[model samples]
Target: MSAENGTPETPAGSTPPTGPRPEPIRFFGTSWVGHDHGYTARRIALAAGSLAAAAVACLVLCLAYQGLQIADIGSFVTLLVVVMFAVCSALAFRHTWAGFSSRPDPDRQASLRGLLTIGFIGSLLAYAFRCLIEAPGEKLHRTEYEAARARHEKRTTRRSGNPKKRRRP
Candidate 1:
């Protein structure tokens, strides 16, 4: 109705149109947007819980190793078992940590399933470590969600007031 395109213009004091709501992250609900509603407490609890679980798992593994020793298993075989677990754990930790920020190759992930399964403790440790710093995958999800919101806003914005009112060539 202004001296521009025929479509009615929004009042200057009115709020802009909102984009779609963000998808919530697990255990975070929608609190990640503002870091409110017990977000900090949940992060602390999860971090401590995961760390404790990982510690307990390690203790059980240690006890198993001791049983191997007490069984008079060959020293060479015991050492090999320890080395294999250590290497596998290291690899699993790296993979799990990297996965928080990026999507891993499915083929590679499938190939590593056995190794990862054998090194579950490492994955737990990685989760605990990341939770201590920030909610697991929070940053990655926040960035992607924000980008999607921005794209939605851009796409929905009225670029032209009325296409039908344009002059023909």
Candidate 2:
């Protein structure tokens, strides 16, 4: 068959061949129960982005609560806070990237649990949502596996020929 329209030569009444295996979705090199890597990366990126936004919001609220102008904070203190935020943001970004392209690293994953704690919290929520997303895909995989197995059994049975036909002879 031509590469563009490649199809398996399944005989009539046989199950159609399935396409390629599904990709796993992951964050920090850990897969979501049923998502592919690409989907997992996007989800992690979103979580990281929201964490940054939360940091900014908290900073604003802290300043408002203290009734202190930005100028009232010492330059050194402001610099330290900004630097810390930057480090955490960098960690979140790196964790998201690692989910997509690298093998699982337990050390790095553990560090992220501390540095990107909000990511952990958000991931817990996302895990529940992923079940909804993955349900259909899981069903499809099961159906395809069953169909392939049935096709294999049918082929083997025919190749061996009917036992009754041999017994009659």
Candidate 3:
């Protein structure tokens, strides 16, 4: 210990050995969130479509269940069930839509955004209709379109206030 002053050293001019760096952790259902193959896009469409379909299916199930028992319409909880199903279904569809739509076109041959946009809107409409039928007088969950619409309205309001001078050119 006295001879070297007690500190261990790495080999001359060489760094100490290290294990490999840890690989990144990929979160479940997030890695594929932005993929743009046609198949992937179509699957996304199917997923969203299925979610909407399932909500309707659940409504039908509720109706059938009620009728089978000869339950009174007033006593039937179809509306509540349908509303719950619609809300859950819409949320599932939104995730699928955003995943496919948010992704860039992998080929870059054309913008896939348009297709994604249409699918997204169509899913939205389908979900909205389903919810409305189930909850006619109730307000939407407001989790769906409120923030986006509010931002758009704010931006538009600001833009509208701007004065446009006559173009001298």
**Which candidate gets the maximum lDDT versus the true structure?**
1
lDDT of 3: 0.43
Instruction: Evaluate all candidate structures by whole-model CA lDDT and list the values in order.
Output: 0.83, 0.49, 0.43
In every candidate, how many clashes are there? Answer: 0, 4, 0
Q: Candidate 3 — which pairs collide?
A: none
lDDT of 1 by residue, 1-169 (tens): 2233222345899975566555566776667677777778988998899899989989999999999999998999999989988999899999999998987899999999999988888899999899888788888878888898889988988487688999999
How far is 36's C-alpha from truth in model 3 (Å)? 15
Candidate 3: lDDT of 54? 55
Ranking by TM-score: 1, 2, 3
Writing each residue's lDDT as its tens digit, candidate 3 over 1-169 gives: 1122222345779986442211211111211222222324444554466467656765666687678457655544766654554555565455444433244346642454444343443455544443323221112222223555666667666753335764556
Q: List ranges where model 3 is wrong by over 4 Å.
A: 1-69, 73-76, 101-169
Report the poorest 10 consecutive residues by lDDT, candidate 1.
1-10
Better of 1 and 2 by TM-score: 1
lDDT of 1 at 129: 90
Please provide, for model 2 over 1-169, each residue's C-alpha lDDT reduced to its tens digit, 9 standing for 90 to 100: 2122222246789886553433322222213333444445555565556556666656764675354344577767766665665566566655544443345478877866776764343333333343434431334444554676787777666666566788652
TM-score versus the correct structure, for each prediction: 0.80, 0.35, 0.24
